[model samples]
Target: MKSELQVFQDYIRGRELRRTPERERILQEVFEIHGHFDVDGLYLQLRQKGVKVSKASIYRALPLFIDCGLVREVDFSEGHWHYEHIYGHSHHNHLRCLGCGDIREFENPALDHLEEQLAREYGYHIKGHHLQVEGYCPGCRQAGAFPAESNFLAKDSNDQ
Candidate 1:
């Protein structure tokens, strides 16, 4: 398997874009992170490492990374987007805690079967899919982490 930097270099060359040290540094930092992260968190990490990368550079590089299949965007309904590097990883889904903002990664063979069934039934070419299941985690529920007002279902349900 090619290293992230090599893959990125190939991608940059293929696109006729210049490969800069800043982009390489950004890629290094991105892969160093093991979990979900937003731009602000990424910027802070880079700064702490004494890398002089700007947020604008990060913003511009993100799309390129996504295009090259090195990264993917994940939304936890946190208003801003979070990103995770997907290179060298198998597909998985997320279970997120609405109360404490915790995330757990899981894989199910049933989803693969369902995807295949759907493709066969609909006659559609399937590429990929993302799933994020959200609810209060066990600890959050036990601790009563967030108030009812934070629960959109409680606020919006007619049954309430």
Candidate 2:
């Protein structure tokens, strides 16, 4: 029942790394994000928030935070990894909007049960899994959002 920061301190202690204000600041900045975020996006966010934290520091702390179970890395098939802080929260899945890059979180006990059943039938131990469904969100569809083509293509069509 230790706090997330306490758990992180324990993790760093086991690794023989000294606790620093930089790691603590990075952890605080990360906890401020309520949704999925990428490394660069997080770095930029911290900078914009006047946190005085360096990108290298954030990048270095992310793996440790993940190992400490404070952040969970998620993949939405966008060629990069997104992370969510899962400490003090239950696990969930994602629904990503292909048109606008919006992401929604969801959870279902049925899906969890199905995963367990499938793993049991295959005689494999389930460590963890990630599910990301992609489609146009309601807002995108309402706005007629579509993936933009190349600038050349747009120019050619406009010249017609």
Candidate 3:
């Protein structure tokens, strides 16, 4: 399989934009991270690498990359958005912690089966799905670190 960077390079080559150095740097950064990152984070990293591109350039390139099916936007439920590369990899859901903002990736065959069953029962053909589960992590729960009480949903009422 072609790497994400190769895929992105081919995409830009076919687009109106040629393979400029700035575009190459942006695509490289996106491929290196391979995880959810806000534009600011990506900009800082690019700057550190001596890429003098402006934040606006990074922002503009991101949408174009997404439109070209190079990257994907992921919302992990922390009121913050992130992006990840989508180089034709297998699909998986995310498990995010509301306490420490940690994101864990998981693939559950049982959940996939359940979704298929539900879709069939509803007389609908399953096309795609995105599942994100947010909760306190094990350490957070053990420490009784609830998420601002407003969003706490611990089964143990006395957890707090």
Clash counts per candidate, in order, are 0, 0, 0
lDDT scores of the candidates, listed in order: 0.93, 0.85, 0.81
Number of the top lDDT candidate: 1
For each candidate in turn, the TM-score is: 0.90, 0.81, 0.78
Q: Which structure among the candidates has the greatest TM-score?
A: 1
* lDDT (Cα) of model 1: 0.93
Deviation from native of the Cα of residue 63 in model 2, angstroms: 0.8
* Comparing 2 and 3 on TM-score, the stronger one: 2
Ranking by TM-score: 1, 2, 3
| Segments of candidate 3 deviating more than 4 angstroms | 13-19, 118-125, 147-154, 157-160
- Give the runs in model 2 whose Cα sits over 4 Å from its true position: 142-160
Q: Model 1: per-residue lDDT, tens digit, 50-126?
A: 99989999999999999999999999899999999999999999999988889999999999999999999999899
Q: Where's the lowest-lDDT run of ten residues in candidate 2?
A: 149-158
Answer with 2 or 3, whichever has the higher lDDT.
Answer: 2
Cand. 2 TM to true fold: 0.81
- lDDT by residue (90-128, candidate 2, tens digit) is 888888898888888899898889889989899988877
Error of 2 at 35 (Å): 1.2
